[model samples]
Target: MRILGCSDICSIFTRKKKINTASESQLARCLSTLDLTALGIGSTLGVGVYVLAGSVSRDTAGPAVIISFAIAALASMIAGLCYAEFGARVPRAGSAYVYSYVTMGEFVAFLIGWTLILEYVIGSASVVRGLSTYVDALFNNSMRNAFKSAAHIDISHLSSYPDFFAFGVTILFSAALAFGAKESSLANNIFTVANLSVVIFVVIAGAFKADPANWNTHPPCTDEDCKQGKGGFAPYGIAGIISGAATCFYGFIGFDCVATTGEEARNPQKSIPIAIVASLSVVFLAYFGVSVVLTMVLPYYEQNPDAPFPHLFDKIGWEWAKWLVSLGAICGLCSSLLGAMYPLPRVIYAMASDGLIFKWMGKVNPRFHTPLMGTLSAGLLTGVLAAIFELNQLVNMMSIGTLLAYSIVAACVLILRYEESEVSEKKNDNTALTASSVLKLIINANKTTHATKLSARLVTSLVFLYFILCVCFTSLVARFTHDINNLEMWIIVPMIFLIISLVTVLFCIYLQPVSGTRLTFSVPLVPFLPALSILINVYLMMMLDIMTWVRFGVWMIVGLLIYFFYGVRHSDISVRKISMKSIRLDGRKNVDSPKFT
Candidate 1:
């Protein structure tokens, strides 16, 4: 009856989901480490391997695109570690959503789950669209032209014609997932192996044709191109390489799909972390090798953006290799499509089972033991999106959701690392806070409930401060990138603030006692590693264009509305709390009454 009160509202929104309750998953634990690794590789090594190397080399970093991929890979690995630690600790289906619920609270969890749905939908749709286009091109664009001739619409954001092929592919994959988890993963493993084989072939074959001079020579350039820093290994200079790293960062986005299988992983504690690290290493090598061969085989300026590998083979008159590479690209895209769709339904099921969304969506199929309804729903939505939307319009919207999720996961890792566990909380509650006591605790650096609590608060505040400082520093650098040699007061002031913020964070993290709770896998350098992950993820998020922020803001607004209207009222945590309170009040009243006996 009093649920609408301000206190009640705050309690419901801020309540954290218990890890014990969340670990009781209905899904079957069928996935091995290799299966999970395949998911990561399949998801991450998709269209990017085939297309990204050539495009970034030609336009952004030139031969230095190899360095760009390496930088991006490093950043991705840091974020991947954060995910791995949480996966080992929580071992749930929702990935960041479940991690946040146990660490951050309910509302934040719902928002993350919502954002993940957005990321998967857009990512899968875009990949399917790309696959359709590739297949169409291979057949001389006959399919696309036929669709264009049949029913062309002149909408701005929508495609010129409906992409039925993309829609069909999405449905087909969704059905495979609904049939069973192991079945889908088996298919993913097959396609992933094929994809990797193609990458190896490309690297080995391209090596014989590679000319070292391509890296050293400045392809004939106009005066404007020269002035823009075009020439040599880094035709666009350090600035271009950094810019290309930002673009290449998206290529590494799919590795976190490994974390989403926490509920289904046969040995999540060890398997999830191993899969994340191993998969990331393999993906980085693939990207690094491909970029090297791509830039070396063809001059950066002459590289093709559309179908780089096939185009390279064509230029060299290697007709056989071109066909082989094309087959590999298709396999890669198919795997990526499956990888993207695989996680969406799992996140949905996690949210729904927690009563954050419709309960029916969380129901596991009796025979298949999969979230069949959720999978079908996700597939339908993704199919319709791929059918109507233009890829370019949808692509920019993908990274923001993922980056935000990564930042929050990293923050969660940092917070969880410093906070007292339940056992410690019971012990620490007895200690009273006083100025002298606080000072003594700080001076002693001994583990106490009070000291641990204080340290956690300090770490939380410092993390927020670090985020602000990163934003300021990144914005200032972007504004004055060209004039760095002639630094002004504006640049100097932000740089100092950023340095101080980071140093303070490090000091607080150093002094804090880490949580006693151990996991099979833990991120090395507690607080520091996760802290860096948060900073890097946020900085990359800021690198996105203004339009991306605008779209992200719109999505957040929609999620907020859903939370306040439906999630708040129907949440399992809220209902259980209310029922328990009512029962306690009734018992107290009976105790106060006269004894009937």
Candidate 2:
């Protein structure tokens, strides 16, 4: 009668259980291509570009802030390609969580699912926090007054409340999430479209203001200017650009979130991949142009935390622009919040299907088809976090979790490819074919060849190598370059969260390996690509101050408690299910499927 920690929960989640793989509940797939793309933009695009871009440009790398965005975008794109292919093949709900369960094991999936909470729930509230801080800045006489008033909302329940304006905003969204994805998607469509329109207009309108001289203002640094402008190209040079890129990584956190909705989307196979790639491409252009303009008009050195973006508007004597920008930011962030809200609950619902969480939370609304209970829990959790936590620190933790997840997902694609190849090579000769068919032969051939047999070992080797590098970047690089005391107190907390989540994931993996899951292709050298992703991402995280690292700890503790107390018993995941549905990739019966939680 009493299910408690690992052992108790393990009984319910055991691999031996032979339950029905047939799903009872099916959700209506109402989203169109446009809706899906809009969801991507909703989660991506906002403050990361509009707000953070300016600060990095001003304070860190000046004009080269564009490079920072480019680097982060490039690294994300590598992982995104893998995400696209896998998401298309699977189209399930748990996103990386579900993907990991099938490909690596349950434990990895749990780690990913647990980390996703940091990425979305905490990340979404950070958006609200960003919105509030910006709004508060406008209402108060000065940015100083806004910072004081904006960081805390009056709540008897939680102390260290930041910004009441966003407090109401988060509450409104919590209720909205309860309604259904369609309603939220619909609201998101209207606001995000209008908001994006403003961005385009700003880009065009600001184009007229550019001084050709402005382009010349900061050239790629000669050693001379490094001494004058405090060194490097623009301000931070290549070095600063790297730092800015890491900091701005927070800005682009939501792009991968789009992949999470594979199950709910009408045509997830085609849609999820398209939207993920297209969304990031669009944001890249938008951010690059915006940063360029801000630097030209005011100069990045002139910008500081006091009034990062609005101060630029202030200089233009377009105080009205500040209001307009704020409106745009609110609209954009709401969409970001919407994109985030849409995927996470369904993941929990999916996790429940696997028997990882409370089964009660997995209930889907019969008519609306939303995972209402999961939605409510995620909303309540997010609202509380938004009401109390600081934005930058929380966002950093979100990035770390997200990067780790992305790196894993990307590596899976390669692993599965090699896995398939190796299996085929065992069945037949892999070396007889010409070099052309050699690669293509392995790729096209099924999982039964002597070559593919070698490929599996190759795949496993690369996966380990890539993961080690990712760990190094986050743990070693982030700690050494960015720490203040050189003690790295900030690193310890998130490590605990990461360690615990990974352990839970490891447990899940033991219950079920890739013995039964799908691996239909032959991929090559996954280690290099994933290692690149890890290196780039860790460098980015390192740029953030110690405070950001501290916030990551808080999120982990909360996620771990929820997983054990709730997710453990509810998830339908186990060794038996994996054995049964390892190759099953359909989306309709997906009504009962848990893709990512």
Candidate 3:
């Protein structure tokens, strides 16, 4: 009944739990590296590659969408590396949620788990809507109209009609997932292969037919006679490229889903890293190749969102190929939906088991050996939401949640790395200030020796400092100058770079370790890389519309309420510590300040 103090709150934040793999309660570890990689491909390479490519090209980046994809790829690479490091280190079920919980604390972990519901569950719903649209397109819109008429659920202000196919697929896949992981993986593998083959065929066929004239810039003009200069390759200029990158980022959501499967992966440390890297590489190449071909096959202005792939072929007089590509898209979307849905239940189970959600959801079905309640709950919710919401609304809401999660994972890596270094410094009794302890050796050596051979950390810090000074000098110059054509560039770009470089340099100088701790596969520049990843994620997140922030805020509030009310009371870790304290305090003199055993 005593009120929790600062120490108690800190204890909750700092608590670390080791997963017991030998326990009977653990999920099956049947997924191989190949299964994980395939899941990544299935999840990451879906509707984005097929649909987003042309839509972005027409509406935002024009021919410069290729650069947008590259920008997105870079952001994803930063996030992916952070994920690879944590996924290897933690090897748990909740992906970012587990990573945050283990490193940051229960509150941060609960928030992340809630955020992931937005990423995976809503992601699945968005994909379902896309799949339904594609199915309707393939079947001449009859099924959609029939369902809409039969139900006649009024939401004309929200969506055209209920997407019954979306709802139906969610149920079907939920049933499939209830069967077990192996069966779900098999289905994903088949659909993914079919999707990739179709993608390859499109890339190959489109290359031969691509016309050079299509690549030329055509500015927006009201006069039909004017054939060029609507805005050129970068119709919207540099701003368009950045905006396109923000939107295109949604395509790279899958690799992290691999992290969620860590509990089920065979040799997760090895498999998770390999799968994350391999899957991302494959998807990046696929996205790049498809974006290039899509732009070349048709003018950017002509690209359509509803059916970018098939419609392109249809315009080129290959009607049969359109239908074929449509079929492939349906398969791709379904596979993506499967990949997206697969992670939600595990996250729910992870959160529930931690007492952050309904405890009943944590229970595994005896027959299926899966989180049956979580699966059903997630599936039904997403399906219902998919039926009612517009596709753009669903898609627009996804990026902010995804970026927020990625930023947190990156932050966790940075925190964990620093914590590990601190712990190592405390534990290791080695007093050597020689060559063995690199930084200390530099400090303890003679001035002449120090002058001749500065430590690696010192050298790196100096280099970072130089860059920071240069950025500061440039910004000052830009601020004082009067002749510059683009005042915005001088005032904004240099100042931003200056801030980032200064932070990086300060971290390098202050956060250096007395002794380095190495891992088999750690991020190359520990804090720097993760910090950079966090910055990029935050910058991209800022580009999202106000509605996204509002929605994300609402989600966070709900998660906090659940954590304080249910999680605080029922937390397994907290309960264990409490019981231990009660026993240790038995008839203790300082009852109020009793020691924990």
Candidate with top lDDT is: 1
TM-score of each: 0.94, 0.75, 0.84
lDDT of 1 by residue, 87-176 (tens): 999898999999999988898899899999999999999999999999998899998899999989898878899998999999999999
Cα RMSD, each candidate: 2.5, 10.4, 6.6
Lowest lDDT sum, 10 consecutive residues, model 1, at 442-451
Candidate whose TM-score is highest: 1
- Best of the two (1, 2) by TM-score: 1
The predicted structure with the larger lDDT, 1 or 2, is 1
- Off by more than 4 A, model 1: 1-7, 21-24, 222-230, 421-451, 483-485, 585-597
Cα lDDT over the full model 3? 0.76
Span of 10 residues, lowest total lDDT, candidate 3: 445-454
> How high is the CA lDDT of each candidate model?
0.86, 0.65, 0.76
Q: How far in Å is the alpha carbon of 518 misplaced in model 3?
A: 4.2
